[model samples]
Target: MSITYLEAIREAQAHALRDDPRVFIYGQDVGAFGGAFKATKNLQKEFPGRVLDSPISEDAMVGMAVGAAIEGMRPIIEMQFADFSIVGFNQIVNQAATLFWRTNVPCPITVRLPFGGTEGGGPFHSQSIEAIYAHYPGLVVLTPATVEDAYSMLLEAVAIDDPVIFCEHKFLYYHLKAEKLPSEALPIGKARIAREGRDLTVVAYSAMVHEALVAAEELSAEGWEIEVVDLRSVKPLDTDTVIASVARTGRLLCVGEAWPWGGVTAEVIARVASEGFGLLDVPPQRLNAKDTPVPYHPNLWMAHRPTARAVAAAARKILRR
Candidate 1:
């Protein structure tokens, strides 16, 4: 049976809970309500007290998770929306992120941020905050693009001793599906070449990876070959894999759903230019959401984020250069 990205996440959590007695889920409405997106549907009943609900305070939620981690429990905090994670910024960046480094006590806490733009989600609900958390050290930031990755990576995140920020794209929750969960996956911090080509390289992560693949297909129809690289985890970016792709194509186009200012796209470009400057035949380029608040209207929201059409257009520009 085909499983959706959302279902994969729920299954992963269930698997973690079943396999490890120390692992539990703590989030707002995660108990009876089954989470804001039902990502934890029926988990409370199956796992009982382990899938407990939390108070409305994000800061308190994260703080409690950190304390639980220090005491040897693996706690997963599911932020209702990615944008709201900022409310607990201090606890996440200060306490959880640095606990291992400062005290030598591992904080095995996984913060699940259902991120990325969805129609009518508005500025307050839709935001890609992965880059913000990625800036902090001692935190592993993961962005899973497919259903298989969603299941496998989440399992890995819970198994990891370091603090993890798991950014699961909201847009792919129900839209993307796979025949079965993966038995194994590439290690975290590794990049996947989604499609191979020799003309140009399009590096993307999360929801943008699918868009880049679509753009590659579109370009293929025009007798242009485009390679698409999916950076599975942005924080521990695979610079070697990216540089190798650039070496083959000699052209790069980084795409991201976040705003265009100093985000993942910019980071990828910076790394390529600094570490692989000689590998490129042309300057690396990037495309991102307009530098503005996410819009409320469907049409405006569509225009705000990077789409397949926009990616194709950007690829064409780089291809012609």
Candidate 2:
């Protein structure tokens, strides 16, 4: 059946609650008011206290989830915004990520962060802070771009015993809609080549995947066939899949809705340059958000982050250069 991005996420949470008695979701506004983005709407009524509303404390809430996970209960902590998760830094990078190696206990904490720009949320709410968690050593990070993956990946995130920070592009929440399999799912860590070509490969995830697809369609009209690779799981990285695609394409364009410097694109570019260096025709290029805070004005915000035209322009130049 056809479902929107937000609906798919809700379905995933509902399905998980129904299937796993140990799995319980709790976060800010997630229980009473549904959620900041309504992702957990009706969950409280559907599962009662299982979908709990916590006081406004990102760090404390995350710590509680970690504690619960270690005690054999699967806790999913949803940070209202991606930037809000920054408040939980020490608990995440130090405690949640290091607990397994520090001792032998499994801390299966899943922190869901809804991210990216929309409605001029200013610097506070709309930050693409994936790099913050991506830099952590023991954390598993995944961002979903499609309806099926959005619904399927949550289950995958909960199944793994490791600490996971799943970044959901909130801007794409209402925009992306598709027919979802009633219950079938997709595996985590396997990057799907959404579109295939030989001239160049565009490796991107989250909202940028939609941008890259639009760019690819425009480029295809002009005779340039670009391959689109979605790095479904970024932490384990699926480097082999990216390298193989670039081996045939000869060029790579890594794009994302975060700052170019230390964002997700930076890691992808580094991997391709390091592992697939000799096979590339030119140095891999990156299309990403500018190295600055998101502005309030619509025109300025449009100019700041990478768009379809920007990605298409970069692809054309990379293909020729």
Candidate 3:
């Protein structure tokens, strides 16, 4: 039976809880309601006291998780929506992120954020906030693009001693699937070449990785060989893999679902330019969502985020240059 990206996440949590007694899940409606997106469905029944429901306050949820982590519990905090995570920004950045550095006590907490734009989700429900958390020093930011990565990376997040921002794209939950659960996976903080090519490299993560693959197939018909790299974790970015891809292709096109302002796309381009300037045959390019709040209209939402067509068009420019 095929396992979907969403199911992989839930299964990963189950495995973690079963393997470790210290692991517990906490979030709004995560108990009986099964989370806003049902990521925690039936988990409360399986794990009993380990699965818990929190108040509506995001800040309180994260704050309490931090405290639990300090007491040697591995807490998993699920934000109803990624945008709501901003409500707990202070607790995440100041408290959980810095706890280990300040006291040498590890904060082994994983915050699952269901992020990215969905039809009618609007600004409040749909947001790609990975870059914001990645900016912090101690936080490990992860964005899994495939079902396997979704399963392995989350398990890794829970096992990690540092606080982790697990950004699971809302768009990929049901749309992507795998034949079976993976027994082995690439380690976290590594990039995978989703599609290999010689003409240009398209660096992407999360949902954008799929879009880039679609764009690569389209470009291949036009005699353009496009390479697609999936950066599994935004923080601790796999610069070596990205720079090597650029070295082989000699052209780079970064794409992201987040806004254009200093997002992951920009960071990738900046790193490539600084560390591997001589490898590029042309100036690096990037594509991102428009600098505005996510719109409720489906058509507008499609236009706002970087789609397969948009990625292809952007790649064409880089390839031709």
User: Which model is ahead, 1 or 2, in terms of lDDT?
Assistant: 1
**What's each prediction's TM-score?**
0.99, 0.97, 0.99
lDDT tens per residue, model 3, 52-122: 99888899999999999999999999998999999999999999999989999999999999999989989
Assess candidate 2 and give its lDDT. 0.88
Error of 3 at 144 (Å): 0.3
Model 2 worst lDDT window (10 residues): 179-188
Candidate number that wins on lDDT, 2 or 3: 3
Worst 10 residues of 1 by lDDT: 259-268
On a 0 to 100 scale, what is the lDDT of residue 296 in model 1? 95
- The reply for model 3, stretches above 4 Å from the true place, is none
Stretches of candidate 2 off by over 4 Å are none
Instruction: Enumerate residue pairs that collide in model 2.
Output: none
After superposition on all CA atoms, how large is the RMSD of candidate 3?
Answer: 0.7
